[model samples]
Target: MMNKSSQESRVETISEQLSLFALNLKLEQIPISVCAQAKLHMLDAIGIGIASSHYDFAKNILHALMSLQESNDQHYQVLGVPNKLSMRDAILVNGTYIHGLDFDDTHAAGVIHASSSAMAALLSVGQRHNINGQDGLVAYLVAIEVASRIASAANGGFHEKGFHPTGLVGIFGATVLVGRIMKLTAGELTNALGISLSMASGVMEFLEGGAWTKRMHPGWAASSAVTACAMAKNGFIGPRNTFEGRYGLFNSHIDSSNLASLEKCTNGLGQIWEMQNISLKPYPACHYNHAFVDAAVTLRQENAFEIDDIKSIKARISEKQVPVVCEPQASKRIPKNSYEAQFSIHFVIATSLIKGKFTLNELENDTIFDPQILALCQKIEYEIDPKSAFPEFYSGEIEIQLKSGKSLIHREQMNRGSSANPLAKHEVLEKFYSNVERVMSHTAAKKFTEDFLNLEHEKSFINIMNQLKVN
Candidate 1:
């Protein structure tokens, strides 16, 4: 049997080797099923980014970035806006907007915000390098694979360790995607991965008090990843064994990362793709709280109980899930900031009960804080169901007692819009149109979405960026 020290060394070596293998693989080798799924994910991410451009937080970030404008070459356009920045800055700002509303896609196993980081890096770098559409799609697929795999390897260790997986693993994804777009060598890719380890950071503190830093985490990773890859290209050397070294990524960040899982990276490399497992978010709240919102929406529709009739609301969820979500004492009415609203199960559930649907607009509105909703929110309580699968899968049960001596109970086993039950293509397009329509007219929005969807066929990234330019 291998000694403990030897085992650790082996694990780190495997991690680095697997990362290089993933980076060197060509896009044409990826399976068709994975490619199709990646396209859907990309569409959804852009749609969400466009929709979020109207959000106060997203607007503030965009406006702040405008002051630090860089020379615009053939780099990607900042979606929904009429400006362009360098590849790194564009990815950072755009990625932040995509996730600012907490409405982007998520993976169950690794808990990484897959699309924001991957798409951000791909669009920005692909445009900068004048990469074709097919090439851009391939870059996105590779990035998603790298990100999701890292998350899977972590296996819920990051959350338990009090780290945000999105920021931690997102950097790897961003670097992988950008390196692919830039056509970096395996050695250069290895150096990029090592450089990224030093920049990866995101804490869960924002979830506690509702801070804007939550959105910034993914953005920062995208920017840092691009910078790391650029540095690697310029002959900057990084620890080759960043993942497996004596004080490498896993050992330092997680309690006990199983490097054996890195084998998953090389297995069925061309045949099976990790991007297929990505799930689109239908609600603009924490993934943990989505099932509760789904359950509550079902109860409201089935019982036909007027909002006034809700006497008491109780949610049955897993024991471990309670602390992260429905902490009874956690303030849930109108949140002080956007990040707070994203994590509060009470606020999300209460809003769903009142409006029958939760959208990006409803979450940001001050009018959402009616006394009736607050009263219902206060009555909300949670119970633990040991059998419920959470973190692994998003599930919840909600029971509401009405004033008429009748109780309505709704249970959700899976979140909607997941791979198990995905949103249709038209729905994705409609979402995009709705978001882009906020800034541009119907004609302009349709033109923009069509251009983006067929980006691979387009001769120039400038073609798309020019459409968004303000007069």
Candidate 2:
């Protein structure tokens, strides 16, 4: 019933506030630690992306897009491939690689992988425009902040709506990041956001048993961001209240009743910096299963439970997590493919106990049907923890019953790599080297490490690309 003027008078609209923040945010205001973390995530995403470059699907998809490009003379590097591609093609391919493995960074409160889309968009656009490292870093941080806050505000509403927050809300953040890098006018940024509403989409049906669609979400979002910017610059106009209006994103895409969630999106803005809260993933699996991976490992190490000694293993997780990570419990216990196993809490717990670790190798096709792991997975059962504070903290509890009539328990309230207990630079470097080295040469890997660690001081993405794993 409210008219545009009345709506404006009602409250500062989401699009208006987000556009202003994206345009005017200063780099100096960012804390030194935040700037450092920004580099870490940017580097981390790139490492994971490079590792995925070897994937058959990654290779094929990039090749398919390359065939469609109008010209190949103007191009950007694809992480591991020798090929250089067009701006949009590079963005889509690189972003898809970063998320291909399901090991990218996650923001718990927003229940979204914040880095993949935003960082990919920034880096891809940075390459195209010759943006400096400092500006690129700022754009990455802004994308994370805006994306994470929006995810946090949505709370778990997107999941309830059967959507993947990364694919759903991720495009807006990427759009804002690209616009920032482009130095778009305030009106342009607003129109870009509005256009993003139509482009935003990612369903969570991949949870049925790890489909390829989830891997494509972030890449698609990055692509949408570039498309949105181009449309805005072409003088296209979009609805102002694309987020909170009658048919806005929140109303149409989510069923959330928490009006305060929207307020939380902009409440602290540059002040609190929600991007800092994003956690670098320790395990190459769903963030929901992270704490349990830790617990299962700890329980196995502490009690030294052998396969024959264990009668049953039980995990208590958030009920809302059941559909995505825990349930179709039977199918999860017997995942058909490597991708599906990563979403299987049963597989995560079983493999963690058996291997004392969960990493890229654990998700390998060879490990998918490991009889020992399957036996252990069969004994694993999950219970919904009513007290779980999910969408804020992804906690876990594990109890392993032994044949000797003894049970040992381990419960974790917070996963490691959260901002409260982030992975140290060395830890992140270790992970980066491990993933990148799989595809990068020893010499290029060493140089890439040094270049990435000192990224903010550099001027051109060309310097970074020079250290890529290209043939």
Candidate 3:
């Protein structure tokens, strides 16, 4: 058997090899189904970004970012904003907005915010170069595949190591997408991956403070990736064995690195694609809180329990899943920040039960903390379920005991908006309109939606970019 040092070296070497293989593969080589999924994810991400632009912070970030750049050359357009900026800046701002509301698509295997990094980078670069829809779609696929595969292999290892997977692994995906868009050689792609790995960063501390830092992780990934690819294009040479080096990503970040999984990253690369594994979010909260919300909503509907009738509420979750949520001390009111609302199971469950539906408005509205909601929230209690599957895919069961001595129980096995139960195209459109209607006039939103639906056939990037308005 290899000694510990030697084993570490082997893992790095395998990781680097897989990275190079994936970087060089062609679009035609990728399965058609995977390409289609990439388009779906891209559409979903763009819609979310456009919708989130209405948020105060998103608008502030956009204005601040534009002010910092101060160029009218129009390299790329900011989503929902008429102002155009450099490719890198556009990607950073757009990517941040997409994830700002925590509404982006997720892949459960690695708990990755897949499209925020990849699609954002691709849209920026593709628009700048005026690349066709087919090529743009291909680049998006390459990026998602690279990011999600690395995430799956790295699985909770980064989280366990106190790093957010979306920010760290997201760089790799963004690098691959930008590299593909730039048409880097396999060697150049390897260098870009190396540079990106070195730039990878994001901490879980934001989860504790409910800070806005998490919103910028994907944006930073996109920025770093564009910089890495740009460096490679300028003849900058990076460590070729970045993935498998002695102090490489796998060995350094993950405690039990599986070199074997690296092979799966490149296995059947042209035949099987990882992009299809992504799940859409039906709830605005953390993916961990989805099943709980689902179960609570179901219980409320089934029992016809009026909010006034509930004497006590008990939520049972898996042991592994409880630490991130179940904050008994949380204020029984609308959260102070959007991040707070997303992390609080108490707030999410209460709002869901009282309103019969959880909307983005409810999450942000101060009025959601009415005495009735707070009263209901205080009665809710959480217990760990032995059979719950969590930190993998979110699942939970909730049991409620009412004042009249009656009991109601509900169990949610899988996340509702997953591939297993995906939101139809109509539903996605509805979500987009709900968000856009908050900021844009009905006529403007309709025109924008029509143009976006036909984006795959558009010729000039200017036409699409022109549709965006700051107002």
Candidate 4:
């Protein structure tokens, strides 16, 4: 336990250290491998944004923002849309589109969709400021490093307490990113971070109704951070002890008994790159359900059994994930919409077993109500895994009993696309190709890919945004 004096010092230490770290980061100082991985993560977010643009939610958000538009900033561009928006509106829409499909990259420990806000801020503000590709990439990496550490320090406490860590912690990262690109002084950056404490908020209530709130969390984080930076740059004063203060992020957002060491939030900032640990999604669904989807697919492939031959199916998951994916059993079995289907472990597993794959296609309305998938969903049940490795890797195990008195089991200790069980570089690019093709022709996708992957060499960030815009 820390005494009041030491605690106050520690609080000051956290925000101050983060502000200096963000301002001091250099592209050359970062490892080549980490930079390469960051680009892939950003690429993944961009592709998802473009694909999400074609959806009704994207159109609705764009229309709403357009109605309120006052600024005629021509530099900012929304993904898959031709209209120019103010930097803030573009950041919000771009962030929303990246996270809209719930397919963005997530740091397993932090459980945050980092690149959504990082990329959104970089493209929108980075372009408005005419930040070059190299500097813009560095700023994006800064956001990832800051966001991952802040959220992972909570040790999944935020999610358990019904707060979405992405919106809460991601704002700090975005703040630092914008502040760094804008070249704010250390005090100004600290003030920007302090202002973010008041702005940070996102709840897990969306899970109950499958609302679109979760989709916009990252976008809101990015947009709010930009506001914070603008305010701070103009000499707005904010608390110095924002992280370790008496009424700070962890204290206000989570229970005291559940909090992890605050020191974990800033230790080894540049040396141990948290961005490298971020995992790209193989399925367009809640990451918690991914391992089970894979387990079901593997089990069905290895054993020969008719879908009718299964007597019962069981899933072993981290108890922490139960409320998020397994429970609301009735709703999980028969999801009412794509958002619900994406979060439902029962729907994902059942569909994976019957169809032998779970992909963006599985989230379609017809698949959500598939008679065969629904029939299998009824036989599924869950138990908490005593040895679960959640908050490290989203692990899962599936056990199926056949009417012929045989039981089969498969366990995915590390989900795919994670650091340990990584997808090949080519595999990551393939996912980007598949997603972008949904909104672009093959030729355009090919051209976009060549330029995007070579982002560091580009002199201007506008060149990248121009490729993403559609008239």
Candidate 3 lDDT tens digits, 1-471: 778666433424433554455555666676666665565567678778877776787888878877887566656777776667777778888888888888888988778897998877877777777777666766777777777777877646677677788898899888877887787766677788887778988887776667888888998899899999899888888876665567777777777643425554555555566666788887777887888788878887777767778888777877655656665345423356668778777778888887778768776656355677767777777887887766456787778888899998888877777766677777776776666665577788678776666555766655665566564
Q: Candidate 4: worst 10 consecutive residues by lDDT? A: 4-13
| Backbone clash count for every predicted candidate, in the order shown | 2, 1, 3, 0
Model 3: number of backbone collisions: 3
Q: What lDDT score is found at residue 268 in candidate 4?
A: 95
In candidate 3 the C-alpha lDDT for residue 455 amounts to 52
For candidate 1, the 10 contiguous residues with the lowest summed lDDT are: 7-16
- Report the Cα lDDT for candidate 1: 0.74
Which candidate leads the pack in lDDT?
A: 4
Kindly report the root-mean-square deviation of model 3 from the true structure over all alpha carbons.
Answer: 4.9
Q: Write the per-residue lDDT of candidate 1 for residues 1-471, one digit (tens) a residue.
A: 888656434424543555565556765676666666677678778777777766677778877877787555424577777766666677888888888878888987787797888877776776667777777776777778777877777657677677887888899888888877777767677888899989989887776677788787888898899889889999999887676567766777777643425455445555666676677887888888888888878877877768788788887787756656766444654465556666777777888888788877666547355666666677787788765766557878888888998988888777776667677878877776776676678888777777777655767655555676643
Off by over 4 Å in 1: 1-23, 69-76, 256-268, 448-451, 454-456, 467-471
Clashing pairs in 3: 12-244, 13-244, 317-385
lDDT of each residue in 212-291, candidate 2, tens digit only: 88888898899899999899988999888888889888888776564426786787888898878889988788889999
Better of 1 and 4 by lDDT: 4
Ranking by lDDT: 4, 2, 1, 3
lDDT of 3: 0.74
Q: List per-prediction Cα lDDT, in the order shown.
A: 0.74, 0.84, 0.74, 0.88
Please identify which of the two predictions, 2 or 4, would achieve the higher TM-score against the true structure.
4
Q: Which candidate gets the maximum TM-score versus the true structure?
A: 4
